[model samples]
Target chain A: MKVRVGEIDLHVQRLSPDAERAPVVVLVHGMLYDSLASYYFTLGPAFAAAGLDVIMYDLRGHGRSSRPTTGYRLEEHIDDLVGLLDALEIDEPVHLVGNSYGGSIAFGLAAAQPERVASVVAIEAEPPVEAWSQRLGDGLARAKPWLITDEAIDLIKQAKGDHEARLSRGAGKLLQTTTIAEDVLLSRTIDPGLADIRCPVLALYGDESVLMEQVDYLKANLIGCRVVVLPEQGHSVLIERTAETSSLVLDWVREQSLVEAE
Target chain B: MSVDVQTTEAGVLEDLTGMLRVLLEEYGLEDAEITMATKFHEDLELESIDLVTLSGLLREHYGDRINFATFIADKELDEIIALTVGELVIFVVEALR
Candidate 1:
């Protein structure tokens, strides 16, 4: 269903367990992807089976959320998430799970307003703006062939090891129409900002992934941080190692005991 | 939990530098270029994100006992800017020890 979050209209899917509870877990998707499509491919029922209510949604300009001509800022993304929860009237703080760019947004929200988050789990996401831009620039310079393609995208999904569903034409449309902001990529570094976080964080990365190869630096900067590496995988650890990733995440969520009803 | 500045440990810097160089080499950078002075952002053009990503590698080889937060705030950005191979070696050795 759609809910109004500030000026944007967000598309969300709330999967409640057979029983209702408190502190629902919200699954926020990354750039050019929708929550239902992406989260289902990686982690969904794992949390549900653990007795937590799951809420998934597309951020503005991705999936089913409202797409503004501008305002694709990371802050906008965070606001959208906040607005979604507020609109849904879920009173308790949420256990947020973010993937890729969504992970960065989750950190942004937690850093800016700690009271709103019960905990956070960030997957192979880039840190923040200055760092992200520098990395992108370096990647453009050192890495060959900068263009993103359908096949490359497919390969990325495969590398993540998706079994939920192959990328449909509709999914491509969902990705293509959304706009990503460069300003958002220039503003925050997750490490420097992480000091403000009081919640527990489980930061996961693929052992062989070049994008998040700097695990030690992240661990160094984040307070109360835990790291997990999936061997023989890359940036797409969620897909490449779905069962293991799901198991680890579900176990973490179970321990947190965050479930809610609207 | 913070970076120590008063130590004069021998070969510590070189050893740390050697380990970093090996990791950098995996990314196709030259051993000569991956020095301690290699500023993760400027000289190497490593984005802050790269620094975040790179930290994982250190944890993998070094183990989790190392304090990541202390290591970051201890040094000057300029010192880490285009870190020299020698400087990086010293930084890691001291931080790890």
Candidate 2:
């Protein structure tokens, strides 16, 4: 189902959508190539099985959510999440499980509206810092040559390559027609004052991941923060170590829920 | 839960196939082929995200009766990467039963 959030309808898939008082676990996916699928393919069902109401949505301009010509700002993403929670009538704090860029958005919401966030489990996180924003801008600028190039599109937009074709086209249009890069460049980087976030923040990093510093930055700045590093993993720990990722996230959420109950 | 003998395996296969076809087409994979033995990654060339789209389709049609995520929970990441369409067919058939 969809929850209309300002400019577009956000596609939401809820496990136990009708559970009025169940502990809510909201999932946020990374940008462009990533979507709710990362969580759905992994921890979503497990969260539901553990009796935590699981909520997953495609970020705007990704997955099945509306692909607007603009509005991909960091603040816009935060608004989308808050608006979605309000639309669902979830007044209480909800556990936020975020992967990569999603972690940044989760932090955006937590910093902007800490009351709505119960706890955060950020994996291979690229914190919303000026450095990461520059990285995103540089990465997208670098990827433009291959991602939406005419030859590349022709090669992937074939009968046997529909999956790649769909993703490419969506991403191509997004980059070609929108101001996402500009938005990212202009949006406020996560501030040092976020140390006031009252929720427990669990930061996990792959030992081989480039975002280790980002995780460390959060640890340095945020309160109630804990860090876990997987020895043999990398940025894609979500997929590289799927079971461990989901189990750890579930365990964290479970423990946090019990803490809240007390 | 006791299996209902009335729901034939072939009948479930048909149901699942139709649902999968709709999803593939919706995702613009209209010409992409599918069979009972089709491996999700190899045959359909599905990315992790594609399985997510398929999972939603299955949920809409089968509801709580077929929990695709739980069906996947038992397998490790590599095992899930190597799963075949027939495995899902059998799981759905048994679950519906």
Q: Which of the numbered candidates is closest to the native, going by highest DockQ?
A: 2
Residues A141-236 of candidate 2: C-alpha lDDT, one tens digit per residue: 766557677777778877536555756766776777777766788777765556546678888899988777766677777755888899978788
Top candidate when judged by TM-score against the true structure: 2
Top-lDDT candidate index:
2
| lDDT at position A89, candidate 2 | 89
Measured against the true two-chain complex, the DockQ scores of the candidates, in the order shown, are 0.01, 0.43
Global lDDT of each candidate: 0.61, 0.78
Q: Which residue runs does candidate 1 get wrong by more than 4 Å?
A: A33-35, A136-179, A186-193, A258-262, B1-97
Ten-residue stretch with the least lDDT total in model 2 chain B: B1-10
Of candidate 2 chain A, the 10-residue stretch with the lowest lDDT total is A158-167
RMSD of 2: 4.1
